[model samples]
Target chain A: MRIAYIKNKLLTIDESFVFRVKYQTNNSILSTIESEIDTVLSVEHSEVLGALRNNDLENEAIYIFREVAAQFERPVLLFSGGKDSITLVRLAQKAFFPAKIPFPLLHIDTGHNFPETIAFRDKLVKELGVELIVRNVQDSIDQGKVVEESGKYASRNTLQTTTLLDAIEEFKFDACIGGARRDEEKARAKERVFSVRDDFGQWDEKNQRPEVFDMLNGQIELGQNVRVFPISNWTELDVWSYIQKENIEIPSIYFAHKRKIFLRDGFIWSAEDDVVFRAEDEVVEERMVRFRTVGDMSCTAAVLSEADTIEKVVGEIRESKISERGARIDDKRSEAAMEKRKQQGYF
Target chain B: MEVLKIATAGSVDDGKSTLIGRLLYDTKSLTDDKLEAIEKTSKQKGYDYLDFSLVTDGLVAEREQGITIDVAHIYFSTPNKSYIIADTPGHVEYTRNMVTGASTSQAAIILIDARKGVIEQTNRHFFINNLLRIKDVIVAVNKMDLVDFSEARYQEIKSDFEELMGKRDYQDQKITFIPVSALKGDNVVNRSENMTWYKGQTLLEHFEALDKEDVYNVGTPRFPVQYVIRPKTEEFHDFRGFAGKVYGGELSVGDEVVVLPSMTKSRIKEIYFYDKKYQTATRRSSVTITLEDEVNVSRGDMLVKVGDLPTVNKEFTATISWMDSQNLNLGNKYVLQHGVNKVLAKVENIHHKIEPDYSGVDESVNSLAMNDIALVTFRLNKPIFYDTFKEHRTNGSFILIDNQTNNTAGVGFIE
Candidate 1:
């Protein structure tokens, strides 16, 4: 029990102290002293209750970022200009403050991203004074490394994995720090903080090194890379709370605005842009919408919301009935869509 | 809000996944889309009841096999606090998965099938929880509907578990028992009216009543330097900060500190969480510190209070949990990573292998195979500051990286 002092004179005891005395067979002396300290105890109890809690998750993430810096030869932060990645950048900054972030940033562009997201990406990198490496899925397609899909429900989401692999090989990066939270998808729920990838960038779910306590093992062989998710334990609300608390800047597309979108299979697809495939019968209509998650325009869905501010967006997320990934069209492809993609080295 | 991480362990047929799914469903943590998917799959599977395992069995292979293959983390929050549950497998890769899951958890839930009573698998679950030194243990006697929710059956299992508890070396563990029907959703989140005699708090109530401080072990402060932040810029040209996380206890400015490996003494000039300077750095907080005197402190060097020092030694004995397929033999070298410090370690001797069922220790062990837990001595190339696992968990534990494979082959809890 913590002994709380009042004005450095009075000694205060909480309810647990009294309960312990009462449970004793004979404690007449203790009871007498408890009565004198009862009033002071109540005052201290409220103070303890109202104490500002420390952000342990933030501390943990900073530790992980430091480990990646110290353990790997070349580490890069995989930025998607999304809220989670934005939070990761702030954490990285906090990890090595008073000094520039040691690593660069990598963005695997699917070439179908929101223009606002692309704009935000460039601004954040410049503000941080960090190098940004952008690789396009179109480049992979043009080089015949990956084939583009062409169907009503086709998306370039799966094609980013090839480009990401090419970039990793090109840079010879030993570690890729990503913002893949466990709360986003089920396959991610089983992910390790320091997930090891084979030469082909495949994740062996069956055989994974057991991580115990704060000791994260980052040792890996040559030609193998580790995918480090520092915020693997954070949830969607935690991210929003962090953004609101830290006052981090994000892309404007996250807020609610009037946009031309079409309805298909109970999903709202952006129609103002020609990036997404639209059928002849699929009609376009304007709706006040915002994206819960940012990805390829063809794969990302928007919800009917009026949250134009960060605070309002947080409230909307708190009261939301649907999961954040519900807006992700790629996950709806199959029950094992994420697992299959992850095995193929999807960030 | 405080976050309480829990690890749940059960045999293949003990309804472990069902309990987690039920807990999420009853608490309304499962979103509408997730519920719909579960409903759709349950209907297609032609089951009268919902296949709760579908909510946690994320992999297609796991779904096809109807078992958990890895530890899947699940998150839920109430107004008071937040919870992170590590749902791990028990049958296939028991030790590796169970130890991995329980390592970071402050509490654990060991599920027992009411019909099957106390089994060997139950002993393994209790053993790992004890080995990992989990502070709180909840013995959930599940499938109460099948046992008629009988008090006699519950007490019988509790008594059996108590016998196993008596065999454990670490006796400070707090244990609680709850009778639940995970499939029927009784006594998991809500009280069970079927068993009116049982007056203990429900599983959810147990979590709600727990204080965060009680779950965490308080010990001496040990700061292992992770990085050194030096701007070398004109504005703060002479700024030198030792960046690290404070473990076990708090460190305040002006406190006398000693740098490890080279016992140079210095006082804390400032504690910076970020930009703002704090008078004190709380436990588990990642903060950068500027010393009053320039000390040769770098990554892998620890900073401790002048009077409170850890054992700086070149060799020690530890209880090892082997995770690799190859056997751990005498003279086998590994990269021993303790906190941020990495040193080359060679296995000196395999003392004995302890049985997970609390049967006894076998002193005749020559080599440690996969999933083997044994007492072994390791000699390090250089000195490492450590404490007994019982004294300070973070400072006392270490991981062994296989030199050839470069894999985390085993974990050690210093004795």
Candidate 2:
């Protein structure tokens, strides 16, 4: 098909200053131009590219992304070894190429992560040659900054917040890029793309500044850092599609496989070791399973499925009756489990 | 499959929660753990049958009062579509919350108790949905079992709603009527065995058949620059790009573009979605574009083609939905947030307080109270490029923030 291209002359400053100037252009030509430019641009960095490619969310991802990349003296992608964070890493790479990712990668270790996720996290940082800063939740617990919960339903999801806040304070990071999507949780739905946190790292959900067209309000007093979600609008399906389209490498546990798992509180608990408590009433057995979301191994449950391939997994998600959070045991504690955690600075 | 977002509004005891409970129960969307919790909670409260409202009504304050205070998002899916129900409060005090919930929704379900045919709450619910331009609305006259599946009552309420729809600004909205007993699991997820007079699809069946066209899609593309992504790495150190999501339309490379405020002109040099480039970036994709020329641009600036310019002005008229407890009166200064731009604005005129019951406008009103929707005018400190809310949702709408408290006091849909 012949591409319709709109090649108009550039305007001088005094010509016009309106925000949006609509012009007619061929759809095919526009797409062709995008493809042609992508071929020539050398996006060596991984983090920026991950974000850049997963661009099917909010329109401002590309525009504010350029601003954030330029504004900060030092910026970092908070990589969690999760699909969302990994995608941010790739976007950061393409964001700044030739030079390594402009800033270091920070990881807040919960001390209870799946082994494969941790392994993948290390490999990614090593391959990208960017500096890696790891903060431990165990350190926070040991220092009495956070207390460990007792019993079978215990998790370190809330403890990671302390470690994350400490790292930000220690590094004085002005802006921390996150992979949180607004569609994932309700409290997050109320969050701004450029959410401001006080020196104490608390989200003022009620007073968020209105976010309008491509501009992000990055104005904040000193000691107040910003939490920027580049992919705030991307749903679970969009992320998976981008992964499949880019062939981005993920942990093996995401695909279906056979493993020894036990049903406790009606969730598929991995029978890995003593890291997770087991009750005598629960029956343990080996079963074929896969994880939809990768969180703290104790809290993240496995689902019964045969979606071993990316295409199959995407298809399964499209037709699945239950929500992605259905496999999570932690949320079963209460209706506002996620909201309460977010209020206390848990990301 | 497409995603459908619906907002539910009804009276305090109109079985709004029960209707939602029935949907989750009949659809089998409730997981085993969630079901167990509901059963335990319901039994503890000494209910004989499972009180489905226990599944939702999450807030501690709400459970204590047995009422929904805020909007709670509930997710469920059928074979063809995924649904997000914004369960909003029915009380008049929470009318603002209802509007907030319905603002993003494509459809709305206004619940009516079978015993109480059509009440004032129903009018307010319909009014907000109409004001927000929700395209599809379902008037679910709940508790049909109490009325013995009476078709006469259903017709009465449907006719009442038709009278209210006459006052709506948008005439193209499609409104459907359904009668069901939420407690008996009839006509919510499955076709009712009792309502033989009803010929339409069941609630779930009706929802499954809706295409994207039946919903309120995003308006014209509005690209609000969020942040700039510039990685000054050694290999390609000179690369500069603007990053943001496109609100309504697609942007492509090699398009003649103009930057806002500065009005710098440039051609789209490259469009990067990670490493690979595409010909066009569709609505809502966060991509970076490098301009062909080295025009100076920064945050809070917009980029678009040369001919399609929005209205650039410092003042305009708007319809405001007052949210705060404080009154919205003339001469009150507030921060008007238009897209990503914030400008100081003052209330220039207060035309009238729009009665929620679709009654005639009250021109005597001088100020708007909480939950009051009014048509007002404002004067901004600086020129804000915008379009009518109907033309471009992203650029046309705005929020009002009280300068003293910094609270989002009101929302404005451009006139």
Native contacts matched by each model = 0.57, 0.21
Query: Model 2: per-residue lDDT, tens digit, A232-251?
Result: 75667667756765568998
Give the candidate number with the greatest lDDT: 1
Q: Model 2: per-residue lDDT, tens digit, B1-415? A: 2457788999899999899988989988776656777898888989988898876675555777998776666776554555778788899788888877887677999998988888888888888888787888899989999988999988988898788877788787898999988999989988888999999988888887776568746655556665566666676678887766666677777788888877778887777665555667666676667789998876567887788777888889988889888898889998887766678999999998886675778988778998888889999888888888777766778888776655578898889
Candidate that would win on TM-score: 1
Model 2: runs farther than 4 Å from truth?
A1-78, A87-105, A127-131, A147-158, A172-246, A256-274, A277-293, A298-340, B216-222, B233-238, B250-257, B262-270, B290-292, B326-329, B356-358, B362-367
TM-score of each: 0.93, 0.80
DockQ of 1: 0.33
Tell me the number of clashing residue pairs for each predicted model: 0, 80
How high is the TM-score of chain B in model 1?
A: 0.98
Please report how far candidate 1 places residue A60 from its true position, in Å.
Answer: 1.0
